[model samples]
Target: MHQIKSKLLLTGAAVIVAFSFGLNANAARMDMVDVSNNNGYMSTAEYVSMRNEFGVKAVTVKISEGGTYKDPYAASNIANVQAAGLYINGYHFARYATKAQAIAEADFAGQTAKAAGLPVGAVLATDVESQEANNQTKTTNDRNNTAFMQEIAKFGYRSDIYTSGSWANNKMTIKGKTGWIASYPYVATGKNWYSTNHAWQWSSTAKFRISYGGFDVSQLNSTYYTADQKSSVKPTDPSAVHQNNQTANKHQQANSSAKWVKESKTYTLKTAVKLRTGASTSSSVITTLPAETTVKTDQAIIQGGYRWVRQPRFSGYGYLATGPANNTLEYVKISVSNTYYTVKSGDSWWSIAQRNGLSMYSLAHQNGKSIYSTIYPGNKLQIN
Candidate 1:
């Protein structure tokens, strides 16, 4: 839970006991990224971008780890930062302790960052701490950190080693690699703190509340950044960035603009899933919706790796599992009891009926059309 920038002064025998601090009382030039898992949500992005407010300059995100440790919503978070016009960088929670292991992690981090289209200038930081090394001696930690930083250079990106300031000064050798210190709220004063330090992670929580996306808060120093790093990554709106084409989210505008003729639509839940009190999995579970159970949703959004839908009379979104284990949930759109549907691309009477849980025979009958009739994209289906 730390970020970067700061200075320290003291050398020789007295270095450990006496060191200087540098604090920028004016945070106007400072940038912030609340470091935490809460960033998995995009509401933070929309909140920050309102009125073109440049409250922060950049955001840091998790990119990869040893196994399937990739952040589920990393892409969404990155896209949100881009839409907010903020510089985007990423870090990996280190799991390796040896040079070979560190190299492998760096390779994974490089590939993941590349696939995500992270800006070239954004620093790829490595989170190396005592726990990452299992409380190994400083000698072993120094060798691994040095090797990891050098390997990251192969990816054509600058690298910074994130460690506690105490470790930077007293525990290990950090001379070759750029240092990002994670000493919180203990701003050093006077006499120009350590000049080698490039960033200061000053707070985990304070001031603005929404930025607390479950992460520590820190600001980066421009001195350690390149001109390109300052360029805000302008990404497409996060709502539209998806690697898969889910039918439920297609041509969403038609429904967005369509006038609702009914209060709710019937949907058959093809598989069992949880109906939570809120959109996120962190929300309390209202009930476990069993397989083949009928569920209804008036509103839905892609969030927290699932389609959080608002069931009828529910105060908030209910979590619907989108993972492989329970992904058979379907949004049935049938022409039942005077229901009408605006045609969408590739939509037909049979397809529409099937999608909505209506019998093809009954759907064609209510719409005043034969089974062989053709329905254009814009045609409206009225089932009475």
Candidate 2:
């Protein structure tokens, strides 16, 4: 009788250990959800509630082509989700119109994601589905898919392609990046999309579980939250508000600089225009120049100004009257450098500086400009 009791006790202990192991395994899996088209633009409060309740680990928000209509909740929603301590990734619905179009669409989505300040774990995913007729155009679709992912990679974030098991295995051949396989047991036939994957969306309703994926799985529901959640957290950068104001100011400056008038003049001097005599004597001279003149332009000597010359009678050096200084001849009347820049749509002084491998402050200094200086499309900028 005693031996029977010992056996029963051992069996009960084994069961308890097995249950504990299962619970531990569940905690390790990555619990995620595809918020693609499912939530019809949830409000901040709704998002917060979902995070607080569900323990959702990650969310994949859908970004449509052309980004003509982005998730209204994207930026703020990401902030709220991050505040609730959840990971967020962006998914682009491939339009498959053209390779260029697909690339453009992905660019727009990546820009939006970066602008939202989504930190680590925010990847740009390409959502490949069979509904689009272009899906049959395997070559075109494949080309577009590859190009789109490449564009997303440029913005310092990883790329992923999200498709069903069968579509991923049979139709797509994404070479470099990871895949987020959509395997709904009810609908999916294949078991896994790839031998190596960064994530897997096994079922929409699956609870968050710890899987092979490094992150913890999120449970599906309105109340999902992740391990990253915290309460009443403020933005890391206190200067963000000030920086935003500064950006606005710089944008205004760019517009103002773009408005400057380029006039043809036959100055006795061969060099580009400098301030007219005493231009800085008072606010009057500075104000007289078209609003296109950059704000806080340096009084130091440099080449290039508001005037250009098509033809010159003499090529030899000659003295030209520059703006007012203690000595009229303070600035050397040297010819302007032909290196000029025509502003592009998203061109910023900082961006230009980065492209040219120049420091923002140094570029501004060399150009006799300020950080707040404005530039615009078609505006000619002197680059010496």
Cα deviation of 270, candidate 1, in Å: 38
- Shift of residue 65 alpha carbon in model 2, Å: 3.2
Give the per-residue lDDT of model 2 (tens digit) for 281-352.
111221122212222221222112111112212332222223211112212232243355677999887677
Cα-based lDDT at residue 180, candidate 1 = 67
Model 1 agreement with the true structure over 294-321: per-residue lDDT tens digits:
6665654432223344676535445443
Cα shift from native, residue 72, model 2 (Å): 1.5
For model 1, the superposed segments whose C-alpha errors exceed 4 Å read 1-30, 34-38, 47-54, 186-195, 207-214, 225-384
Off by over 4 Å in 2: 1-30, 41-55, 174-177, 187-195, 205-384
Q: Pick the candidate with the highest lDDT.
A: 1
- Cα displacement (angstroms), candidate 1, residue 376, comes to 47
lDDT for each candidate structure = 0.50, 0.43
